[model samples]
Target: MNPDKTLAMVPADTLVVLDFETTGLSPNMGDRAIEIGAVKLERGQVIDRFSQLMNPGFRVSRFIEDYTGISNAMLAEAPSCAEVMSQFAQFIDGCNLVAHNASFDKRFLDAELDYIGSGYSGEFVCSLLVARRLYPEAPSHKLGELVAYKNLTHDGVFHRALADSEMTAQLWLAMLADTQKPQLSFAQIHKLSKTPKAKVPLYLSTL
Candidate 1:
């Protein structure tokens, strides 16, 4: 996979929204990322895309195969996790990242990168956490629910990495649209996502 060299070339200003479909919930229990997806955003627009499925060296559960539509047969034809992550490490290097339910993705990212002796330098912002503060009136903050709540474009697909990342990118851009700012620094975006739901209005006033 040819990574976008510009991502590392302009590290400080780039935002990459990412998502991963894994074998299970916890990396500590040996769950591995089967697929990774991401879209690079520039000035609130998607500028580049990435998606890859990796072989985890073992078969996933029947349930996971059904849920993600990734099977042992498919994984056998894909590159190994270490091989795919090496490219992914370059793909995301030196760029701030956003993910829905980021804690889960971060676990796998950190773990896989560790195995490959590679890692990213950028910080992470959780779209899930940010949605709670930005759309407090929404019935749910899940990627799928928020996609529906905010009328984000979706192809009726979930549990797949690329589609979820695309939808999350829409959800993220919608939140930025709420800011009404032409550009926000990485620090500002990080701060906004971390702001309390009640004080979000006051904080945006400062922005």
Candidate 2:
């Protein structure tokens, strides 16, 4: 659970796959997350869900509103970011986290959690990075693209937190299923993902 330690394999039972819909690209620029959605998966099945819209203490631009379908009016009625993150911290307790393009989510997650004086112990896995290694032949690695390439079901929506998180969860599972190495530990798979793609087969053969 050390933050500095990368996980070795996909969690076998419980983990959380999450997504955030934000006002802009960088939390460092003061853009805040407008909505957060996550699915708790246990043994490849969704066991619980958490979704919330948070007021960012500022109005979002029309471009953001349009892109995310989350208007300023909708955020006006939502709880403050602190309140939502406080509960989110609880929701993710003792669970590893997975996110597509996890660096982006990790930045926002750490920022929001730091602001609330809270934190989680679980390490985060980047499904994006994993997919790049696992599916090098795929034309595109975007969440939606991977979903279709893997033939995962979706509700035909993107950019929203919950829907995107659901797609990410499916993509994560599909990638794991494709690994063909059920005996590999989570740490071993994590190590395999970080290995150069050309060397993956060599590493796996040794495993």
Candidate 3:
């Protein structure tokens, strides 16, 4: 199937909003995901959750520990990366995925899943990219900024996987609500996300 048709097959509520706290940037540079969090939503309501901390087989730097509050000592007793990712892969199976800056999460996800001999088939939606197109006047498109910009409720915490994922989910639903087109399919929204900001209205009008 074409990409749009594949995305259209997924129901809005079935999107898996996810986040990863990693050892560092660029999974290709040997950075590994130290924690994974995801929420399954249906019709803008959260239906399920998955959260886990993984032992990356190396000590996380003090900076990372301070940033994420996930210490190496804490991860010492956690499951191995392979173990947690195996379960995560199953949890997100056959579901569209969403992340704030999806490229970051997508890189780690693909790398980690590749390490586990697994992969997801569903398309990924970048809430950040979509927000940029949908709300050009907003001061910033950062997840937290968008949260505040849209007056979306959040726990006031950032960086940890689950909290960020939940916030991203809310931001995503808010973006969809702002679109004012409830009838638009996921594929349609996905297409709009890739359009230049100036052309979004024109594309939506065509829809």
Write candidate 1's Cα lDDT for 116-205 as tens digits. Answer: 888887788888988898888999888899999998778998999999999988888888777776466666767778887788889888
Q: Report the lDDT tens digits of candidate 2 across residue range 105-143.
A: 999999899999999877777889889888999999999
| Candidate lDDT values, in order | 0.85, 0.86, 0.89
User: Of the pair 2 and 3, which is ahead by lDDT?
Assistant: 3
User: Candidate 3's residue-wise lDDT over 1-207, tens digit each?
Assistant: 675467676655558999999999998889999999999998778899999999999998899999999998899999999999999999988788889899999999999999989998788889999999999999999998999999988888899999999999988888888887777677777777799999998887886
Would you estimate the TM-scores of all the predictions?
A: 0.92, 0.93, 0.95
- Judged by lDDT, which candidate is best? 3
Number of the top-ranking candidate, with TM-score as the measure: 3
Error of 1 at 193 (Å): 1.8
Model 2, stretches more than 4 Å misplaced?
1-13
Ranking by lDDT: 3, 2, 1
lDDT of 1: 0.85
- Cα lDDT of model 2 overall? 0.86
Question: What is the TM-score (0 to 1) of candidate 3?
Answer: 0.95
What's the TM for model 2? 0.93
**Model 2 weakest lDDT span, ten residues long:** 4-13
Clashing residue pairs in candidate 3 are 13-41, 13-42, 13-43
